[model samples]
Target: MSGNSVPGQGAAPRRSPEALPPRSKLAITASRVTAAISRRAGKGSGSVIGGKLALRLAPDLLAQLSVGLQVVLISGTNGKTTTTRLVAEAMRAAGPVVSNALGANMPAGITSALAGAGDEARYGVIEVDEKYLAGVARDSDPVAIALLNLSRDQLDRAAETRMLAEKWREGLRGRDAIVVANADDPLIVWAASSSKDVLWVAAGQTWQEDSWSCPQCGGVMQRPGDDWFCSQCDFRRPSPTWSLAGDQMVDPDGRIWPLHLQLPGRANRANAVTAAAIASLFGVPVEAALERMKHVTAVAGRYDVVDYMGRKLRLLLAKNPAGWVETFSLINPPPTPVILSVNALDADGKDTSWIWDVDFTQLAGRPLFVLGQRRLDLAVRLEVAGLQFQVFETAAQAVAACPPGQIEVIANYTAFQQLRKTIKEAAQA
Candidate 1:
C-alpha cells in the first residue's frame, strides 16, 4: 500500500477494542445523561450537543475511540452525508459499521458516534466537514479517505475552495491511506493526488464555475466533456479507475454494474458510484455494494415524503450552488408544485448571495411557492430570472398554497432541519 500503514496491517494487528486506553467514565456518563435530557425535552436529536459536552470533558474522545478500527472518512462540500450512509451500509459486509448519518460532520459529531458505537464495531464511516477534514483524518488515521468534490459552501466557516484544497493537499501529502477521489472534480483531484496512494473515480461533476482556474498556476483549465486539464501548468485530471455511464458504474476490470438508488438524478448515481468505489478498496464487491445502496430510501430526509397539512411534501436539501444545480434537475418535467425554502441562519450560511449563481431560470415556467426567512431574497432572484413564484409566510401556508396534491420541497440546511423537526413533532403529537 505504498508505505501507507492502513488498518488491516501492523505486527500485532491491533484491531481489538482493548488496544486503546480507557475513556473517562464520567465524561461518557455525562454525555448520555445530556442526550437523554435533550430527547425528553425534544430539543432536536441532541447527538451534537451531547457529543460536544462529552468531548469538552475528555478532549481526545474521538482519537481514543477510533484506535482499533479501520476508519473510512468522507469529506466534501456536498454529498458527504448521503455518501457516508451508503458506504457505511456497504461496510456492514465486513462487520459492524458505525456512522454519523445525521449530517453532523464535525469532530463533536464523530465523538458522539464513537460514544454510541458498540465495542464489537470493527469499522467506522465518518462524514467530515471540509475545514475539519485534516484534523479528523490525522486523529483517526483513516484506512480510506473519499475526497468528494469541493466548492464554496458556508463561506463564513469554510476556507476558500483553493485554500481548502491546499489544506487537503497538506493533510494527505504523506499519508498512506488509499484515497478514493472524484477525478472529475479538478479541486478534489488537486487536493488528493499527492497522497501516497490514490484511486480515482470519475463520478461526474455538474458545477464547473468553481474550478475554472488551475490550482498549480494562475491559468485557465480546459473543459473537454467531463475531462479537465490546465493550459499553463501540468495539472490535470487523473484517469479514473472507476467511471460512470448514465446511471451505471463501469469498473476498471471491464465490468459494468447498474445502479438503482431510490434517490433520483445523476448526482446521486455518482454518489453511489463513489461509495461503491471506496467499498471496493476495502474488499467489498461492487455488486454487493450496489445491491445494498439500492435499498437506501433516504438520508437525513433528503428524499423522504411527509404528510403535512393535507399535502404530501417530499423533501430535498441543497445548501449551495453546486447542490442546487443537481437538485434542480430533479424538478424538471415539472411535478404538482414546488416549495423553495431558504434561511440565513448560521447553519445555512448567513450570506445568501450564492443563490444568484444558481440557475433559477430553469424554473421559468414552473410554479414555485417560496417560504422561510429568506423568501424575499429568493423572490427577488426569481423575479429577476422571470420565474413566477408565490411567497408565503410559513411552511404551513406554503404547503396549503400548493395545488391539493403531492408537493416537492427543496430547502437549504436550516430550512430542511426545521421542516424535519416540525414533521417529527407532528408525528409524535
Candidate 2:
C-alpha cells in the first residue's frame, strides 16, 4: 500500500495564498470574520453561517480552498465522524491535515473547515453528508473518497436506501478519486462499483435489513456464510483488498496488523480498517495508521465518559435502527443502568416513528431510563417491547437514580448535543 503506484503518495504540494483568486481570498477573509463574530455572540461554532457567506461571495470557495491539497471525502449513514477523525489523524503522519473534526458534514460546514485551514495544511479530510456527496465531490476534487456503509436514516427527510445508492452511483460515475468502500454492504458496493478505481474493505455490517434485496436486479440476495451475491444479477460482494480478521486488519499483502483501538465495538474496528486503507494511499503504513487510530478514545461527544453527580456517564449516539443496533453492542452488560434519549427536532428528523423500527428488546434486562424531549415516545416503544423502564426529566435525575457506577446515555443528534452541553456546563461550574 505504501508503493509508488499508490494514488497520493508522498507529501501533497502546498497552495500558496498568491495562487488563490482575489475573490476567493476575500471570501475566506469574510468567512473568518463572520465565524469570529458568531463565536463571540455564542451562536455555536459558526461554520455553517461563515461558510454560507463564503459560498455566497465566492461560489467556488471550496474548490479554491482544496486546490493543491490531497482531499479525502468520507460519507455514509453512520460512522462518518469517527472514521473521518481516524483518517485525518492517520494522515497527519504525512503532514498537516485540516478536517471537520466537529462532525459538521454539510457543504457549508465542509467549506468552512477548508477555508479555516492554514497554508501549511497538505491534506484535507472532510466528512460529507451522504446526500451532499455529489456536490462535494464535484467541488473538492478529492484524491480519495471513503464510502463506509449505507442504511435507513431519517426516513421522513432522507431518501430510501436504494435511492441513496443510486445517487451515490451517479455521483461517483466519472470521478477520478480512489473510492475506498465497504464490500460488506450491498448498497455501498452497488454505489461504489460505478467508480473506475475502488479499494474494497471487508468491513462487517451489523444491520442487514436495508440490504436484503439486491440493489441491481431487485431480487433476493443470497448470503451464504460471509459472502453475499444477487440471486438474479451479477452484483456480488467484491473480494476485499483489506479485511478485518478479529482484532487484526489484513492488508493487501496479507500482513496482519492488530488494532488496539480505544474506541469500542466491531463497528469502530471496521472504521479503523477503512481509515488505514485511506491513510495507506498517502504513503502512511497500515501499522502506523493503526497506532495513531488507537489513541482516539472519543469522537465529537460519542464515547466520551463524563463525571456527573458522583457517577461516570458514558455518552453514545445512535440516530437510527442500524446505529442503535451497533450502539447496543457497545453498552456494558446488564445490571449497569442505561439512559435512552431521543428528540424529534429538525436536525434529528421530525418523525419519531423510526424508534419503533429499533429492537429495544435487547435492552430489556438492563436497568433502563428514558429522557429527552421525545422521552414519552421512547417510553411507548419500550413498553411495546415489553421492557421495564423509568422515565426521567433530565440526565442528572437519570444518573442519580442509577446505581453508583458508570451509566450509558444513548441519544440521537440534538439530544446528544444537548446532553453534552449540559454536562459540560455543569462540569465547568
Candidate 3:
C-alpha cells in the first residue's frame, strides 16, 4: 500500500461482532450485508466491516468512487474529529454531506463512510487519521483539506508528528487540493507550505506572545503585540485571515447566548478556531459559522456531558498525549474533581511511555480519581508527578467513589468506551 492508501482497502467490513460469514463468500456477503445494514441503519449506504474486515476489502472499489467525490479531509494530532464535524456541518448548511462521524479515518473506514454518501452527493467530509491521510489522499483527491495542529500522538503504528507531516508533504504533492493550515503550529505550517491555496489561520494575538519564539532561529519572533511576527529572521508567522481572538471573545451577535463548549480544555479553543476557519473557507460566512459554533454540542465520548441524578458528568476521550494535555488544560484546581482512566491496547498504543511526555504537573493541585485496566501504572505516574489521586481497579468502583455533581472523567479510547457503557447501564438500572 502507498503511505496514503488503506491496505486491503475494501473487503474488511463483512465479518462483524453480530455474525460471521464464510471467508470465500466474504465479498458477496459483505455486499449484501452492507446494503441491508445501511438501509436498516438509515445511514445512507452499506455498512462495511468495522476494522479488520475493512482491511480485507478490494481497493478497486475505492478507485471507482474517487473520480466523483468532493472530499474534505481533516487531519491533525488533535481536534480533527471535532473540527471535521464542525466543518462538515457548515458545508451541509450549503448542501448535503457524507462523512465518517464516528471517528473512523482509515481506508476501510473512509470507504464505509463514503458508502452512504450516495452516488449523487456533491460533498464528502472525512476526519482522516494522520497516518492514513497520505493513503487516502492518493486514493481520493479531496477538494479541500484542513491540517490542524500536530502534537505527540500514537507512537506505535504512526511515526512521530514531524515524520507524519513529511509523509503528508510527499503524499499530497501535486494533488490539486486546497489546503487550510494552523499557522501557529510550526510543524503544520511547514507541511502546508508544499500545498497550494493555504489559508493560514492564527489562534490569536495575545495567545502567541509567549509561545511564538522561532524554533528555527532561537530568536524572539516579531510581534505586532496583537498577532505574531518575526522581524529578525526570514521565518515569520502568517496573519491569519480568521481569528478566535482569545478566551475573552464575545458572541458576534448577542451576550445571552452562552458559548456552549462541549469539549473540555482551554486548548480546545484552538480546535474551535481551526473548525471556524475551515468553515469560513468552505463558504460559510464567518458570523454565521461562529453563531453555529455557539450551539455546538459534543460528539459522544469526546467530552460529552451527562447528568447523574443530580451530579454532572463530563466524559472526555483522551487517546494520546495531545488529548491528555488538552484535557488537563481544562482542569481547574482546588475544587473540581477529575477521574482519569488509561488503557493499554495496541490500537491505543501499547507503550505507556507517552504518559511521561504528558503535562502531569498540571494536576498538582487538582483532586483526581484514577481508574482503567492500567490504573496502577497511571497512579504511580501521578504520584511520582506529586499529584494526589484515588485509584480504582474498575470504572464502576471509580464512579461509585466520585462525589455527586460536576465530575469530569478523563479517559483513553477503551477506558472511555467501558466507562460510558458502565455509566449507561447504571443509569438504566
List the candidate numbers ranked by lDDT, top first. Answer: 2, 1, 3
Off by over 4 Å in 2: 1-13
Question: Which number leads on TM-score?
Answer: 2
lDDT at 165, model 3: 68
What TM-score would you give candidate 3 relative to the actual structure? Answer: 0.79
- The local lDDT score (0 to 100) that residue 39 gets in candidate 1 is 88
The TM-score values for the models, in the order shown, are: 0.95, 0.97, 0.79
Task: Please write out the lDDT profile of model 1 over residues 138-241, one tens digit for every residue.
Answer: 88888899999999887676678999999999988898689889999899988997898988898888998889999989699999877789999899989888
Better of 1 and 2 by TM-score: 2
- Answer with 1 or 2, whichever has the higher lDDT: 2
Q: Candidate 1 has which clashing residue pairs, if any? A: none
lDDT of each: 0.85, 0.90, 0.65
In the order shown, what is each candidate's alpha-carbon RMSD? 2.0, 1.9, 7.7
Return the number of clashes found in candidate 1: 0
